[model samples]
Target: MSHPQGKELSIAVVGGGISALAAAHRLVELAPRCRLKVFEATGRLGGVISTVHRDGYQIEQSADNFITTVPHAVKLCQQLGLEHQLVETNPQYRRTFVVRQGRLHKLPDGFLMMAPTRLWPLAVTPILSPLGKLRAALEYFVPPRRDDADESMAAFVRRRLGGEVFQRLVEPLVSAVYAADMEKLSVLATLPRFREMECRYGSLIRAMRAQRRLHPQTTHESGARYSMFVTLRDGLTSLVDALAARLPPGSVCLNTEVVGLQRA
Candidate 1:
């Protein structure tokens, strides 16, 4: 690959996820003189990230909230002249995760990034066996280990605590994030902060607790303005439609598939 300084270049982006849309948008901003082609496999861009609207109902496939802590999505909205259209999640559902069985379980308050440090609930929660609970509770007393470089979400929870926590708590939580299986999941890729959290606080719980101390309000976010789950009011297709409208005439070749690429 060559970097051309002080020269315009044509760019092609594939798979119109939010990333591709953002890339195309940036190419327009930074290199309007350069040609931009977004080749999406389907008829529409945004891939699994599109939204739908039907008679007062909105639906989404994937690529949901960009973290409030992360400025990229929010800033992009602002730049798109969409700040007013930015709706925070519904306050009622802001502190939500998911539940399967017959109980309403709140992921421990102040727990950030999928690690639980603060105790009371972890000890009493039925999600773990008494032994598992004891084992997890032991994190407070056990000194941090620096030798281990990485561990799977399954192995880590099972070793430090028990299988129940792995299957019930970590599995569902991790799966929801990755849409993947926990056993083969890469901890380093998904949860690198574990190493940092352990190293910094000597315990995951302590790190979570400390983080909570810094952002106490994020803990009790009930009835707060906006929520963690959110989407556009006009449905996501509005975004793709707008993007398609901006393309130059004859820029798109429809109903055609290119199977390979090579240099002449």
Candidate 2:
């Protein structure tokens, strides 16, 4: 929609979640002279993003950090002038642990999500059996499917890696992220990059290797790559607070429920 200059244009933004707040902020940026109103159903904002400080400890109730691979979150922080407050994950404790047979085992180094970039770590890791490791290693030789149709993540992983790798490693790791049945989860809907890897380089391992070569700086160290995950030192809620602070006074309505909208 185009708003002529000096014309009083009124815009109503429903909800108070991060998306809504960002939208409101964008509207203000685009049309400073326009009147904007924000309606929130609850007393507080941020939706699932909540941070609380209690008993001399600061805790994040949800969404502690965001990955930087997708730079939208980082760009938003920069736009809010919170880049100085951004902090990276500790380099020392970056490895993820998975439970197997009532034991906690560290995820193999260079093992990103579903693919393994380093063979030595996979060879020594006890999480996978000799046969499973062999099958996973064979992923480099596997042929890629030419079909453009969508496929389930379970099917893709099993076809490329193997049943053992899927059940033990891929399944549990993916489950932790999506909390959905892999058989029903569309790889295109969730992680299309893995699918793209198959189509582009014929294997996930090959794609990862090429990516590392392209950006070696990101993988210079082992364990959790601290640069990938970023958050504000104060908390994620600080973002919400910053956006809310930018809106004009009396423009926000708390405990206001919007049932529907109609174009008049």
> Evaluated with lDDT, which candidate comes out highest?
2
Stretches of candidate 2 off by over 4 Å are: 1-7, 178-185, 210-226
lDDT of 1 by residue, 1-51 (tens): 223665557676665656777777777777667666676666766667767
* Candidate 1, superposed: residue stretches over 4 Å from native: 1-10, 97-105, 108-113, 220-231, 235-237
Q: List the residue pairs that clash in candidate 2.
A: none
- Root-mean-square deviation (CA) per prediction: 3.9, 3.1
lDDT of 2: 0.84
lDDT of every predicted structure (CA atoms): 0.63, 0.84
- TM-score of candidate 2 against the unseen true structure: 0.83
Model 2 C-alpha lDDT per residue in residues 1-264, reported as the tens digit of each score? 455554578899999998999999989888787788899999988887899999989898877888899888889889999999999987666667778999998878777777776778778888899999999999999999898999899999999999987888778877766668999999999889889988999999899888888766545344445458988999999999999999988889989988987742
- Residue 247, candidate 2: C-alpha displacement in angstroms: 1.0
